[model samples]
Target chain A: MSKRSDPRLIERVLRGEHAAASRALSLVIDEAPEADALSKAFFPKSGSAQKIGVCGPPGAGKSSLTSRLVAHYRKQKLKIGILAVDPSSPISGGAFLGDRLRIQEHAMDPGVFIRSLANRGMIGGVSYTIFGAMHVLEAWGCDKIIVETVGTGQDEVEIGKVADTIVYVTTPSMGDEIQAMKAGVMEIGDIFVVNKSDLHGSDKALSDLRSAMSLGRTHEAKPWEPPVLGTSALTGKGVDELGKALDDHWTHLKKSEEGRRRLREQHKEELSLYISRRVYRSALDKISDRNLDDLVEHKIDPASLGTKILKK
Target chain B: MESKPFRVLIAKPGLDGHDRGAKVIVRALRDAGFEVIYTGIRQTPEMIAQTALQEDVDAVGLSLLSGAHMTLFPQITKLLKDRGLKDVLVFGGGIIPDEDVAKLKKKGIDQVFGPGTPLTTIVDYLNSRLPSVKKK
Candidate 1:
């Protein structure tokens, strides 16, 4: 384990060797004992990459739009890292990660590194592995890291905690303007894009999104106003504009106090995620089957057993 | 912490547009607790190899129905080898003669599954041959 986290491997990762980066990411995903050391080694080299989160409801063309964004960023010679998250089956604890299908054109590009991750039972459109994976990509010298979340519903706003900028995508005919009015994910967007603008009622979706943005909540004015744009990831329509919007948002973040606050919040979230995972695993490991059976058979209560496990 | 699941890349090479069988394998593998990355149809050898490298899959499953498996399978394995992914288990499935199975294996394909082969057999094969239960 110590040898795996050796300085030579760290050096290769810093040099952006594909094999090293992949190996480092696997260590993190597997939660190997050396992952802590690797994370510490990579932490200082990270934070330079622009982290963008693409999220929306299922079938909203999140993957397609993410591929378009990768292309847009690559045009400027920026090395990009893509982490596409897919759902894991609760029944089998496995996943079918197919997001790479849309981005296959970039499969052979040296400037781009794309990996598909199973959500691994995380409910907020991403897995706990994501934070570590992002650090690995950042350490690998990716100028931009785009995380495409598993299709999220209204409340899966965890991306807002992880990404520097969130691009919320949606398609037409999803619902009425009221759908956008109801708060949850709609509020987290730094940029709202109505993808598949070529489809019917795209204009209406665009208008609805715009109207929703204008009806901001009671909070004081934010320096950055979320822009609502229409785009077609298929024909490359409005993608360039979306790219510029992302860049502008990054610039805005760098200059604003909100950006620093977001950085602090991101670190806090990372720490909490790590602690939660550790606690969950340890608690489960400490639970005895007798206690589990007792709880299941109503011989003991859950709260008492939960407290007992924590004490243990 | 959650145990890392074995990741596999299931790709279709050559001009075979039908992915029904590949999709079935994908689902079966997923149900059997493997993370399966399915690159749709008509994937070139280069694309498959690149995806496997980036995904860092423990295995690459090539499904070819276009009868070009003889050429494409070796190309993919060679590409994977050249890219420092020789450790990745390379497997194939399609309509191939029994004689070609040994030939494919000699060229770096680890295993071949024919049509109507039981899904559990495929699952068990992966479970047994995957490099380690712990790490990729």
Candidate 2:
């Protein structure tokens, strides 16, 4: 836990050495003491790579679409990094990460670097180490970084805070139109994709998504309108369009005031995230078994105990 | 000091279709509190090593039932080493002959578990060997 990151290793990582990058990623994943140094060396080198988040329900072909997107980007000679998140079992604290199985074609490609992550009890579809991982990838010179979140439900909109763009995937007959009209995660999508378009009723799903977007309240004074695109990852259809849409968003973000605002927001979010992590760690460490028992037994009230712990 | 969960990669490295045994091991390893990345079936040595490098797993578990263990297991280990992963523990399971198991150990495979080996034995072996959990 007190490992020191070699400056030579950090240099190798900046030189685009995959092995060194992977090792740095391990340090970040473990939250080892050395990771703070790695982050300090890598943070300025980040923001060059486009961070894209892919989220959807289970069985929605999120992995397959991510694979296609990688292929699409690779065709243009872009270096790609992927972080695929899967849920950890509450009972065993273990996870079966299978997202790489769908994207195995790129396993041998030197231009592609993929890492699997367990949620580690963090909610909102991603692990807490994700930001640090992104820093490593960006420092390693990846032009595009794709973060595939754990299969998300209606409430896991945390991807919006982490990525520059969010692609929300859905399948045909997944839900009623009213479900699309609802608020939470539905409102955070920069691009809404109805994947598995090869299936029947895909047109209906597309129209429903389009109508829902139009009927919902708009982002006042926003320059870019979110597009609802249909894609079939099996046949690789409409994937080209999705790529173009993503590129357009990237360009818009560069040239628009809204984009600059988002970048500022992301930095703010990063600072707050670090503060909250330290606060929680120290606050939780302060709690004792007796204090917990008193709270459970209703002896010490919630407000007073919270104030006492925070004050300490 | 805080330690992360040990990550293990479970892969089938040949044209083997018998995967019930492999799935059982995967489940057992998961239950024993190790994060396992399972590449469904029919993987090449390059794929397995590449995956191990990207995932930064502490150990690699190769399961083969096609009797090609002799040809594939060593190649997988060599590829892992070629990728600068010399410290990763490589283990195999299948119908490997006793003599071949000895040869594999020399070629850098740490251990070989045959059919009918108890799940706890595999789990305990890994827990003891993984660098993530240093033996105290």
Candidate 3:
């Protein structure tokens, strides 16, 4: 648990050495010594790769569409990294990361590196280790990095904190789910994709998404409105348009510098989260288990007890 | 960083269609606070080993219900060992008989767990082998 990250390994990764990137990433996820050093080493050279978040409800073909998006990027001869965040079972700390199954054909391609992160009970639809994984990818010179989120509830807005652009994919029959999203989660998408267009009611899904995106949205204050495009990842329909839409969003970010600002905020947020967790955990370790029993017996109030613990 | 949650892969090797036991163990492993990667059914030894390599997981548990443990489990262990993954412990369960269990251990499987094995029996077996928790 206290393994020091081999600086030689970090050095190999910096030189774009083979297999070193994955090894560095393993250390990153394990929270080994190399993670901090690796982060510090690569962050100054970060912000060069574009980070995009693809999210929606389960069964929305999010993975399929992601495959198409990766193909599109690879055609441009760009290196790609995919971090598919799959929800962990609350009962068992296990997850079925089928995202790789859909995109496994590209497994051997040196240009593509796909790994799935078990959410480990994180509520933001992403694993806590995502930024670290992204760090490895960026340091390895990935041209584009895509984060496919655990298609859960409205919490997917967390992706915006990590990605430059957000693409929310849905199907023709997802109107009910979209209706339930209200304005909060729907407002997060920079581009809306109504996938499975070859199916019936495709038009209705597109209309439903467009209407939801337009109503009471605060982001419209900007010049760009979230565009709703239809795509069928199975037949590769409308994938090009979706790719174009992403390109346009990237161009806008370059023009407005919002991407750079968001990247800075992400780094700051990641650091703060790590600090809060470490500091709070050490504080908790100092508190006695007897105090927990006191709380159950109505012997002490939580606010006062928390304050006392922090003061220690 | 605090000690990481143990990462284990629960896979159904070969052409077995039944995943009920595999899924149940997945829950048990997860609840034990181990990071369980449940690779779906009918995976080849190649696919399972490659997945472990990419994820850099700590251990792999193959759920072999088809009585192919003699052939399937050893094949997977060999593949993993060939890829310089001898350190990645391989454990399994299913209809593996007592006699075959010894055969498997000889063929490189770290442990052979039979069906209905207590969750902690397996969980403890694993936790026992992890490096002792020495403080930084």
On TM-score, the leading prediction is 1
| DockQ agreement of candidate 2 with the native complex | 0.61
Q: What is the C-alpha lDDT of each candidate?
A: 0.89, 0.89, 0.79
How many backbone collisions does model 2 have? 0
For candidate 2, what is the lDDT? 0.89
Model 3 Cα lDDT, one tens digit per residue, A73-148: 8898888888888887777555666677677666556788778787766787787778888888888888889999
For candidate 3, the per-residue lDDT at B43 reads 84
- The stretch of ten residues in a row with the least summed lDDT in candidate 2 chain A is A1-10
lDDT of candidate 3 at residue A303, scale 0 to 100: 93
How well does each candidate superpose onto the true structure, as a TM-score?
0.95, 0.94, 0.85
Q: Which candidate leads in DockQ? A: 1
Model 3 lDDT tens row, B92-132: 88888898888888987878888667888987987876444
Q: Show the lowest summed lDDT stretch of 10 residues, model 2 chain B.
A: B127-136
Clashing pairs in model 2, backbone N/Cα/C closer than 3 A: none
Candidate 3: residue B89 lDDT (0-100): 80
Q: Residue by residue across B1-136, what tens digits does model 1's lDDT show? A: 3566889999999996889999999999999999999988888899988888888888999998878888999999999989978678989998888989999999999899999999999999999988452244
